[model samples]
Target: MIRSEQKSPFRVYRGATIDRDEIEKLRAGTLVGSNAFFSSSFCEEVAEMFIGTDPLAAVSPCQSPVDRRQFVMFKIDVDLNQTADLIIADVSEQSNFPAEKEILFGLGTTFIIKEITYDIHRNLWYIEMVVSSEMFELKQEYTDFVHGCLKYTDADTLFGTFLSGRSSDYPAGISHLQRHLRKMKFNDPNRANVYFYLACAYRSMGKYEHAIEYFHRAKLLQKGLSSQSSYAYADTLSELAATYSLLNNTAKALSLLKQAVTLFRRILGANHIDMPLYYTRLAYVYWQEKQYEDAHSLLLTALSIFKEDMTSVFAGLSFTKHTMGLVKHALGQREEAISLLKETLEIRRQSYGDDHPDVAQVYYSLALIYADTDDKRIAFQYAQTALNIYQAKLPKHHPSLKRASELVERISSYQRESTLPQSEFHNVQE
Candidate 1:
């Protein structure tokens, strides 16, 4: 039996030999040759899992000398009653191997144990392994020996890290990971998902053109997939609509948002958590089109949904309130609009910190409201605050920066006119 009293520092194939040159290469952290029997994809998958890590410790019922230079081997087995683990594999059955052997050799396949565990219910052993060519060579050097022993970080883990950064409102981190993923060509199976995330990251960074490009890419990919992806396709459509709205393409934005709303209603039912978001998005399109009554009605429905499921939907309530405040202002409910806008601003500030673009948006909105009410001093202050945040946090050419600059300039002009002498003011009025 291949047993170690002390935990094995590294795993190796029993009876396999490595020459001095191969040993030196192994120390250098580079795999020298491909396994002729396995496909390139399979080899790449295995390399991703085991290349930069110490060999996994496993107990194998085979006796062999301790050869530090030997390549690590993983074993594969199949059992009818055992549940499959979540490890990535391209497993296939081979019947020629002995059922009870710890090491199995067949016509063109070798199975070395990767992991073994007992099934409590069925009283059977479950084994996970890799099937590879007999002559496969893995070369590593001194650097490989040190850094290659670290635990593998899979693509899913890296994706989750990017997502976590995005959810925490760190656009720069999301941009960095998006670039890395693109460079790695890492989204083979889930190109839509990767593209969607990249779109969202670009949107958050105020790169609307790039955001629109990626959103369209994601939408196209999602459309090409089977019906199982309908929900995702709909969500992508909704996101694309939002990007269009930001670019002031109101007609296309409204059309896409309506399509998205229909799909969401069909797939998720009326009361699903996504319902409020769809309603709010549709409301935004209406607000953009100056359909105040329609926008107000949709915002009310969205607010009702949010109130019913406050816990699960609390994160979106502030956004709904912000939109509703604008609608209320358009409807001439000035006091109610101010109250809602103030509450939304406070919530955003607490949730995202003072310097976030979302907070800047709220500042700009308040400036508009106060300016309409002839509160020029307060309007100028809020506009200047919004301008500072946009200049600091957004690109120079971003629409939000341009709008804030215009608002600040207009407010400054008004302040200058208001401060003119009575005779000069009368002359200008005349």
Candidate 2:
């Protein structure tokens, strides 16, 4: 009966149905529950339990399934480091089937989905995840942001504010924001902040009209906020522009992005950590306009700023890489674009885990790029995976969701065509 406490950190395996996209994105800095299990023995888990950092901690082993279709085989790489007390035990000797090394976790234990991929040949999904220590740090970071936002607010409201923006819990986020707003008078100092976040929540959920209305309201109420502050009204302008960009209103997006960039640069100066964010946003809009040169220039500026101190602005750094990757592709730099995108993908996985809309966006871009080349054979797989993540989180009519769905259908048709006889293919084309 080997235990994690008596040994170094290891891995466990299991077969699971991905029922929810929101994994371990904490509710009020507390863990949501799961029935996931693990083991060190092959084929199935032993009954022993142990503790480690990764919720994906290993203490069990199992043999591969004979029927791939019947059981989804997963190769989950779990990273368990020093953080919290999550148990993983190997009880192979104690089990009736000793070959099946089983493991267990503490109740209410949580985890994050870092990355996911499909193996066509093995019929397996590779979920590359590093967790626990990272999870605790991430949660603490978000909780600190909540403290900074609402100094006197209740813990529930603090957690609610986190949901809409960071956790991708739009339903819970909106409910909390609406309730919080009702308690505030029209002239309350925090009213603008509430309006700003409410707009953010609505935008995240594809409620563009409501988002726009609230953004305008926030803007009107934000007159007293210092223009010099990095988190002032300028941020609202940038967000409003993003919502417009999603609706194909590039003109509005471009104008607002320019305004936000100017404010960030002139007032806040180039020293602010978020300076690159607006520049990248502008570059994204520029790409849509086919102003490739302008976009490239802005991306260069953004990337340089990001390289100064990468650790502090990890998310911004990844976004810069992601944007630059797309721009590189548009410039016909396919190899460089793919490389940058792959780097961005790993960085985002390490930073956000799986199930984030940002992660899905990366998958979406990679699929589009691959679908256009000789790698079109696997393009459908990438597209389908992206569509799954998008479906779990994004709204039905959201542009990203709509585009991913269309891409999946288009790629699926291509895949089906490849399976047809030459004569049949011609018939279908006709």
Candidate 3:
């Protein structure tokens, strides 16, 4: 227990050595003040003397495993001053170790002390003498430990690997980080970020259901952290809406997308660089609903935003152009559609190389246009090219590969029928 002396200018309180279990009990809020060893008479005397006195005026010496001994002071508030029943003194100055002097250091800090009682089971002495700075230091150390693991194995490298389209490596990297975070008891806000990134990784791998699950988990966690704001939460909602759209849950997708748009507008403003991307995403959803006029208007706005930023060669620029081409084709502006599609295809090929899935998609679009124009030979060539790329890059039963394969067969059948005898050709065509 700490002993106190009443001096003229300041009151000195000396504290007892605390055990590990006692410290844990204090942190857990299981330690009660009534059980402290200090006498009621001693508590009342100290409380009366320090009633209006600043907590900084009283000093205590505390023992630390790292520094051996340190002097810590507290900024006592009205609650603490009124509740104080005993005085603790500085014990570190008596030791041969150097005195680490700090005065009025812990001002503005808050501490909670339970009501003092005479229960023998509770150690009130430790409660009265515990300095807030010591607890603060311990918490800071724990936060450092959790963050140190992230620095040791950089997340940026893993994110870069994911961005490079190495889907096989991406999940493993994020999963490893997630496991570490869970094991370390990371708090809600940081954990939510991890879940959000995991959802994005799953989306990139075409696992829309898994992406939706993680995105929902992230959203719930984000909501729990009411004091914190996360920009990534908005992005997660937008991506989740896209996954819903892929699953043909159009109603849910539109609702979530609208929420995402509102959040992005609130957090980043409408003039931010990311605004055009969000607009483009909404436009694509409208396109899927076959609302060509609405989609076209959104695309025009996105294009204007991109042009204002002078980012015409950006990847989003190509994506917006590609969607616009599809919109034009659906509107029966075949000539304009072909020109836009060709421009998008060239941009994609230059940005992602010829073997990329995006390039293959463009090839499929070109094949469709040529087939509609009655250029069967050119259509067949483009379809074959698209099919080869899809078969190499995608799963055998992927929808894209199936579509490309079907187009190739249809074009081949047409070519064969056109070459037969006139009567035979008519019969085969029919």
- Can you tell me which runs of candidate 2 are displaced by over 4 Å? 1-146, 151-158, 227-231, 418-430
lDDT of each: 0.60, 0.66, 0.59
Give the TM-score comparing model 1 with the true structure, all chains together.
0.58
* Best model per TM-score: 2
Model 1 lDDT tens row, 316-376: 7777888888888878898898899799888877666788777878888888888776688
How does residue 122 of candidate 2 score in lDDT? 42
lDDT of 2 by residue, 1-430 (tens): 3344544555565554332223222233333334554432334222122211123534222223233222223333344545345555556667786555555554434555555554444433345433254445656787787676566345555666688756878888989989988887777767777788788888777788999999989887665556433456788889888878777688999998888888777777876667888888888888777788998998898888777756558778877788788778888898998899889888777766777777877777788888877676566677787788878887777766777887777777777775311110000000
Ranking by lDDT: 2, 1, 3
- The alpha-carbon deviation from the true structure for residue 394 of candidate 1, after best TM-score superposition, in angstroms, is 0.6
* Per-residue C-alpha lDDT of model 3 across residues 6-38, encoded as one tens digit per residue: 322332232234444444445422222323333
Pick the winner on lDDT between candidates 1 and 2.
2
Number of clashing pairs per prediction, in order: 18, 29, 9
